[model samples]
Target: MNFDELLSHYKAKACIVSVEFFPDGTYGNIRVVAGNKAHCDDMASLNHPFEPGCPYEACFPKNPNFEEHCYCCVHEGKPLHAYVDLYMMGLWLNMFLLPLDSDQENIGYCIYCYDVTPKADSSAMADLSADTAADVLKACIKLRGSGDIKHAFQDVVEDIRQICGSDHCCILLTDDEKCTCSIFAESLRRGSSLYPMARYIEGFYTITETWPGTLAGSTCIILKDERDMDKLREQNPVWSASLDYAGVKSVVLFPLRHGGKLLGYMWALNFNIDDVIKIKETLELTTFFIASEIASYKLLNKLEVMSTIDSLTGIKNRNVMNNYVDQIVEGQVPMPKAVLFADLNGLKRVNDEQGHVAGDKMLRKAASILQSIFHDGEVFRAGGDEFMVLVSEIDESEAQRRIDQVHYLSKITDDVRFSIGLSYGEMDIRAAMRHADECMYADKNAYYMANPELKYR
Candidate 1:
């Protein structure tokens, strides 16, 4: 359409206009007054009419809804006329009109198009914000349920990045024993100098210097410089490596807490304030909530560890042994496997001659010996004077040789000796155990028959 006519048509609409196209197809700086739909329709029909001979006729169709003219000549990705057509369509409906090129062939349309209608209600933005928060909360809950403090922190880092619109996130956990810290997670960027997935650290000075609270639970430290960083790294090796690994000069640590105690701290890295709202307050609150979940997970993990471990020997207990065997018999445990049974021979002699204290010593010493001999196996005290072994990838013949070595060595110590019975193969472990026990009794009898004086009565 002619510049003056198009201008007069849209003048009354008060729509913002920054660019206009002239009859010569060149861009022109233009301003216009607003108008009603009829005025716009009249202007389109007068100048850029829907006639055969019009140069701009390629853009305007006989659409009654066509409003003020808008030329998309500025978008050089496609033909100028096609862009103009799309731009004119957009003006009519307040919608997106992506132009396409004919050379696209089999690749489908070259341009993308969409119609964007103004949201009638602003509350949808609020709903979107709430929905995002809920999703982040659910993700944090899933991470916490994993029973891994490190993994939970990692998931929180990613969640925070999504919520905060940042490029990366991380978790820094304070070591209660060493008073040091480490990087638990980060944006899985791969590089030798990048943030190592598992690194110990102290504190990031950027957030900590202005943090106003203890470093243990500090959040959102924007790295401003290197002055305080040296002091932090000097405090611990873990701190130094974590900082270098995360490639983040600025960091925030949120202490995971539960039941009025601090469980661990999470870290967020590479701050992007533009994407996430209230980078500090939002992250702090989010971390606080996540900490409780992480704490519960850590507690469960500790309980699991305690359940499987023998307090005295620091190995799997009888309960663990039985459970492990069930797994092995079912072929759930990885093949190949074997079992060893060991009995301490002269415990009564030790109790009678050297007293109960000596007997206890003998038991502990025997356990130690068994541990050393079967270091490759999972060793356990099955009961008094008895032990069990679960060996992976070793048959009974190989196990018998190892037992002979242990037995031959016992001759060097006159005070304590042992009669060990071994059963191998992928047979029933309980029945194999019974066979080993009978064999051990047979050996014990042979030893007493050879030397009655050596027998403990």
Candidate 2:
């Protein structure tokens, strides 16, 4: 069909309200405005099949045959496509075909697609504008709730590519330590042969120590400027080689950020720009939204870590220790464990006579001894003046030997001391703790009886 016939067919399909394809392929210029009001205003200067260069230039460099142009392409002289698929997200059934041109002068075509949401025909344009904004917000939330931040962005990029009919989409995450970026995830069209690197740590966007401009290096657009983009391409041999292998000609990278901190960039690559515009626009909103949500989730994880762990000592806190034992007993983890109950001796006397500072030092010293002796088992500060150790795989003999070692060390240093009572059993962790406590108290009473002058309380 000729241009007019093609346009008529799409308009009737209702997927497109008006379609125009120009011989210069700049027909996208004549297509009415699309996307949200913000985006439409941001991109108002150019028609469809947006060529390389600034949007303000007029009349195709004043050429004799193509001199009527008021907007220019960003690529200057490269081929472009400007068709808008009216059927994005299965939301719209109306199609409008506007052919810009049919000859070499036609850089590309522009399509103003419509959606199926039943607003009045006159208000259809307004509906299309608002629908994308709402959908983008929802998609952003859905991705954040998925839990895996990297994978969620990858999924969104892929979904956007599918909606926009692109060949492939991928995301590059920045590695601050390495001062570089790498592809973390990608989604390629079914038949298209685009495959990104396996992981992000390998530096995929580099050249063999040369000035970049090969397809690989060209892909990294450090900033938005296209001038130094060639330098980025020249530096990445792997990326350049991969792009050539996959026949990818056009690419758009959307940098993701959270509170102005750069998280990474999402890239949409296709043989044509039209195939990726929708994805680019959709990701623009989704990226920031996803970043902010992920930041919040990670902060919560950090807080949880800090709360569950004891700062002065590396072992579990008393509260956490109780829960740990409860879980092991209630869930029936395994057999063969020991319970050790220990208390610091002479601490009250040390604080009363030598000052609390000395007593604190002695307690810390005693804690260190326990930690060093029972490093393999769970050690806990069960109370202000008491501590506990729970072990498995050793019997009463071994436990006693370990206790003797602590006793001998205390005699030599005379800095601090502990009296430990031990018990071993398969079940009833709580009862075992009680048994150890009872034994500990009996030992204390015996010591006091033998040396009444040494007793402090």
- Per-candidate Cα RMSD to the true structure, in Å, reads 19.9, 11.7
- For candidate 1, lDDT tens digit of each residue in 236-256? 445546566556554444555
Q: Model 1, which residues run further than 4 Å from truth?
A: 1-136, 144-154, 165-168, 172-175, 178-186, 189-193, 197-247, 273-277, 331-337, 348-361, 395-397, 408-416, 448-455
Q: Which digits, one per residue and each the tens of the lDDT, describe model 2 over residues 241-305?
A: 65555565655554555554556666666634443333433554455465566567557867876
lDDT for residue 99 in candidate 2, whole number 0-100: 33
Which portions of model 2 miss their true places by more than 4 Å? 1-229, 233-256, 260-276, 328-336, 344-376, 383-385, 398-417, 441-457
TM-score of each: 0.56, 0.49
